[model samples]
Target: MGAGLPAPLGPGGEAVSTYLGMPNVRPQPAHAPAHPLRWGEPFPEAAHETLANGQMRRNLAHATRTIRDKRLRVTAELPDWEALRDAGAAIKHQVMSELPALLVELERNVTARGGHVHWARDAEEANRIVTDLVRAKGADEVVKVKSMATQEIGLNEHLEAEGITATETDLAELIVQLAGDMPSHVLVPAIHRNREEIREIFAGRMADAPAGLTGEPRELAMAARAHLRAKFLTAKVAISGANLAVAETGTVAVFESEGNGRMCLTLPETLVTVMGIEKLVPTFRDVEVFAQLLPRSSTGERMNPYTTLWTGVTPGDGPQEFHLVLLDNGRTKALADEVGRQALHCIRCSACMNVCPVYEHTGGHAYGSVYPGPIGAILTPQLLGTGTKGSLPHHDATASLPFASSLCGACYEACPVKIDIPTALVHLRGRMVEAEQRRPLPTGWATAMRSAAAVMTSGSRFAVAARAAGLGRVAARGERIGRLPGPLAGWTSVRDVPAPPRQSFRQWWSQHESEER
Candidate 1:
């Protein structure tokens, strides 16, 4: 362990120096409740306003469709894609089921190879561990590769509180950091902004930037490179998140399109990685499936531009010290639910969000959680639990996210691990509806639903109600009904209601039966 680093514990414990600089956002995040009960509140009203950003919608639509099409084509070429997906799922499940054991094995090998391992049960603990490790080495600055785990845990924010500056090496991440904006996309954090916006960010924020830095890819790369080069060369510590950690050799794998990760992962004197427990694979043989699945699934490439792996440390090459922080952070609870467990099978690919209509419209921020889109609907609830006031509880708020899909099953078919996203949405909806009934609703709405339930449950009652409904529809003529009163406002807010039939189905059925007799 790093000098003076505190022992790892679940939550609300004294944080050790090795786990330094992590801020506790809360003892319990809103979406992560302590119990299994469902909460009924819908998504916040802000969702509607954000969904109206036509420019962001256009950019997202263009990028996602282009990537989605390429992914489908590449994925189809594999004769045994289903089998490969099944293998990935099975492997993840097995490792998570025996997480403690695999993690122990990983620890043993890492220690033997001159690396240190730390266990963190949640986001706070993970950040603290990384920050403390960096601070202990007396390094006031650190470089970072693109790491979703680090973002989810808010590691940069933690480092900032301790007066340690962390420079992002990834171009997209750098742009997001420079602009002081939250990441809105998994693959492209700055997807909401156009090239001109990026140029503006660079021009305004970067010192010693070229006067002629255009929005061109190469030019932008050069601008970012020039800014990051000095930081990378001078920094003594680097932080990262691993795509896959091989338990057999304690090797961590990082895949990137740019060479920035290579610079961060290799150049620093001390390297600290905070990775999810679910990121482990049993052996190198498993790489064949994931290496093929990941690039195509994520970037729609046959192979990523740079795939870096390091086990412990090399005597004369790379960092002299390596520390791996294995994070759990509600993963165990997620694993406990059989139906919801498949969410752990995700490889952080943005494919689902790309094709997600709701995500395209609202962008990732409105999901109001780290995880977003179809994946967020299923994942946020599971990770945070449904009983709390967090993002998962707000899943139905967008109300549009579940209905956003044509239920075309493209997300499931597109998933590298083959998660059934539509199925997960239906399951979550049932939970939401049941929660709505369990709690107190407005008197008028509750009474109407109760009365309707009674009428629908009995044949005789339904017959009478249907006839009354038919009379009301007839009075309105053949034109579609555009409005509704009382409890129906939630449904009618975005869509017009169709008029009821002039004749009830029961009446037609009875007449047909009499004719047959």
Candidate 2:
């Protein structure tokens, strides 16, 4: 053990004598409470509407391309990038397998360090806890760090309904909040809006914006800074989400590009951090792996400009009161899934989203979840229990998420922890299909698939179907078929299909054999 590291202790308060390997596994909770993973329309329907927004599409394309190029450049500078990824993945895997023991150890250490630990089974529980904590401090408003966990639980809206104001300190988050819009990207929430549009938002919604605020990045940033500086100084409480939590030390860390996160961590009298259960690493040293992988993968930088870490409250320095809420809204349920569990390895880097062709065009809004893009496609469904038993009903919006990707394998390559996203996608798709099979009334998709299966099972039937497909050439203009009829029309609405060849492969093969003879 390191000199300053605390000795590992078991539940009985004595120093643990064993090697402290993976602990006895506990059964996953039978039910996962309702979460805010999905909303509004299904992915296909939402994508259709978003695809028509030419300006949004252009904005997303440019922003994603720029970020992707930067990530490639920075990652190329590391000669041991793949090794780092492997280390990060291994650390996370160990954390998940030994989660039960780690959680107890984390709670013990955090309590010893003068911080309170709260366990929340769902989003509602988490919101109630945070809201009550703020009210106890007699605070009506709180400054916030950019936190995905809070967003996943709809904490801001919940606070508003409870008569509390939550001011987002992250520039992009503030923009989204002022515009009353959902975040479109993980790293850059306002990515779907360009500078001119942002200037318009700031001028219209920001109360203290200068009379002639320009769209230049510097001007916009200064305007936001002036507005938030007052809030940072005055707020009594702050809320944050942890990028990584060390079970060994009971320490929580938040990484950010801007300095706002540091303000949130230091200036406030009370700090509340909401973190997902899966964000734990067994030891403090394990953080070294992600400290390297995350910055380059997320912001395309050598390191984050601000990385705030706190073990607990510090008297006469920073927040005097600290609370850590460990939330398991749907994590245990997701962890139970053997094949789909890999989705939990995500570090919220958003590197996969930057490289995704689908997200580049349709944007994150199409996914209809707090998490968006390729990772969202697989993560949201499992978290929402889309096709799982004893949970929420199989929602069309959540089930449709798995099919949102093109399975281009770009996400897997871009993932810092090496999550096999494509495999998880295919596995979730199969789960969705199985759920569909149980329905008494068949959907159009299921019916079509069954019919095709029957026809393809027999040689004669397949041959006849092939010949019938040739008739489709009549509807084709040259080599492309436009606007297919009836149920298939949806396929051609966004993409053109190639016209069938003049002759089937079987017929061509037969002709060639006869000629050779």
Candidate 3:
């Protein structure tokens, strides 16, 4: 099935290999039995523990850092990168503010081109729409292009319940699918595993996997190509996520390193695309900026290998039936936030995750959601709202995510859409501290701050407080304060609070002046 290309009839007297040019294969979706329970709980203790594995951490660190390095070098080549970023942000903000109207326009354009558009308010609706679309075609199987939105909505699992199967055709997605695991990275879904783990997964899991498959990179890719070829050629339906959808023409675009996305988009009789409403770009010209920004930021390449574009259905060619499922799924809620709302500008290049120290250490699963890294920290809290099953609302252990950065601001610099992540982190931190505080700040703390504010405002009070602080410091010696006796304990737990200086600068200056005289 993997070796021989399956020739399917297209136009008159023409046959082509639909699924990566292979025969007798079928794309089947990985089972997602536990996906429902995954909702509500932002952090699953089990997934948290899974991230502790040194092997996964090592693999992710190496891969992400390598990609980050390449991205930096390539991004430096352009002097106007910042200009492009601002434009991307501005365009996205415009879409977010006017999503409903833009979506309606998009529907009109798509429908004019013979495409059907479906609106999904949330994950369940999105899944139902896609599942029903496949069922309507009487298809038991469908092929998929790698998409974070589908993962968030658990589309594969949803289809399984309705007796439909969806198989992933991308190489990394195939590895994740065959291993019965969740994707831990955005651009590279299987980044946590090395070639050895991949070899084991294919050998152990694939029913028709060639015996004694070597761990060579080329060998593994060939194996996946063989496995997915059957699915691509035989499946009646294909599902995908679009990187950018042009509102002017209702044209959807997907950028990918591998040619698999192209194959998936074109091979099936029916095509269903689930895209976030925020993905809309005002015009085709806007693609110029993203086309340059995305590939470099994501894969560290100047240009992606395959950039696929389709406007509805083409005459007698490539997926006669086309459905666009515009997914909201809490995006509207994120949009409503004024300060935190800039998160929607994310291009999903994943440059933020690659440079993130927290992501390097904890890996993606610790966040316990589809979107991970800096973007996830802000996006997840807002999308799920404050009080999810967790006690802390946004203050779950993932709250630790905001603190994960050194406040280096590298993420903001590397961001393609110019999201101010440090600013967002600070904002989220305020929310977390407020959530953890329960009642208003205590009277004593409030009074202390007031006293400090007054002292700083008035020189006389300032001098008095400085003298008092100096006296306390002299009494305490030079030892670091591990715990504060009063309301300041939270500050001392994760940090060493330095004792006050022995003398105020004013006193020292006075003594020096007298000595000089």
Candidate that scores best on TM-score: 2
Candidate 1, residue 490: lDDT: 71
Q: Which one wins by lDDT: 1 or 3? A: 3
Candidate 3 lowest-lDDT run of ten: 1-10
Candidate 2's displacement at residue 471, Å, is 4.2
Full-model lDDT for every candidate: 0.71, 0.81, 0.73
lDDT of 2 by residue, 1-517 (tens): 0000011111231321111111212311112211122454677668767887776676777667766887899999999999999998898888878989999999998999999999999999999999999999999999999888999999999999999999998877887788777788887887766666666678888989999986555566677778988999999999999898889999999987667788889999999999999999999998888989998898677876678889987779899999999999999999999888888888999999989999988888888888999999888988876743322123477888888888999999999999999999999888888887788877666778899999999999999999999999999999999889987896898799999999889999989999999
Taking all chains together, each candidate's TM-score versus the true structure is 0.84, 0.88, 0.79
- Candidate 2's TM-score: 0.88
Residue pairs with backbone overlap in model 1: 5-18, 6-16, 19-128, 19-129, 30-389, 30-390, 31-390, 32-384, 42-397, 43-397
Which number leads on lDDT? 2
Worst 10 residues of 1 by lDDT: 1-10
Q: How close is candidate 3 to the true structure, as a TM-score?
A: 0.79
